[model samples]
Target: MRTVDFSPLFRSAIGFDRIFDLAEAAQRVGEESYPPYNIERLDENRFQISVALAGFRPDEVDLTVEQNVLTLEGRKGDKEGRTFLHHGISTRSFKRQFTLADHVEVRGARSEDGLLVIDLQREIPEAKKPRRITIGGSSQGNLTQIESEAA
Candidate 1:
């Protein structure tokens, strides 16, 4: 059993029930540890996910993102009439998922050196970003009445 520390989120987050839902989903997908992967943060807004697929090809893997969830599925081709002296490398099918924070989006994906690399980014919209409001001088004296000409 892996212990996850959620104290960080508990400290500053409020009204975030989806996070806990994702945690429950992770527990349900436990102990299928194959085709190891890594998640790296390149900067504040950019991230990269690398999955090690030793014997899998680029076309065999599929990636999908929907409603803040990123899913990666790998399908290995069937082995025909070839016999192996020592069975070592595993090309088993796997479905890995990741819960993305708000504003997070999948940028692109590629296969390189037996690894599937996926890029992601968090882009907050202009309307959602914090804005600095300029406090102007009192509006009471700024209001002027328009002098009307004689009809």
Candidate 2:
């Protein structure tokens, strides 16, 4: 197996230490190329992730959120007594994980039309959101005069 060098990328970035760890974890897990998935930005603060799960029922799949990670697991029971000449469809189990931002939260998840849609919304608290402070003309005027006198 070949090794990937990510030290250069990590060194160039200012404060993305956690991202490097997540990337290493993902590499260790290999790949789950089974079911395809798509992530779409619904709106300014809302997003949706859809995974193509044709043979999976709602109960067969598990969706969970722990800390800042969203994990989706699908497991199908044994299909006995049924014989197929050509098994084209895949009922294989898979687990997919997505790392979310700090303020993002999973609203709900539902399976429909062989697709599992997971909704996410960013809920920034009032204190966390950016606030604009009004600059008073009087304060600016005093600072300007002081600078001019010093100069």
On lDDT, the candidate that comes out on top is 2
**Per-residue alpha-carbon lDDT of candidate 1 for residues 10-58, written as tens digits (9 for 90 to 100):** 6577877567666866776747777789999998889999999999887
Q: Which tens-of-lDDT digit does each residue in 1-151 have in candidate 2?
A: 7557678887788798777877787786645576899999998789999999998899899999999999999899899998999988899999888989888999999888999999999887665554445567565522222212111
Q: Each model's TM-score?
A: 0.74, 0.75
Give the clashing residue pairs of candidate 1, or none: none
Highest TM-score model number: 2
Off by over 4 Å in 1: 1-14, 22-30, 134-151
TM-score of candidate 2 versus the correct structure, residues matched by position: 0.75
**TM-score quality measure for candidate 1:** 0.74
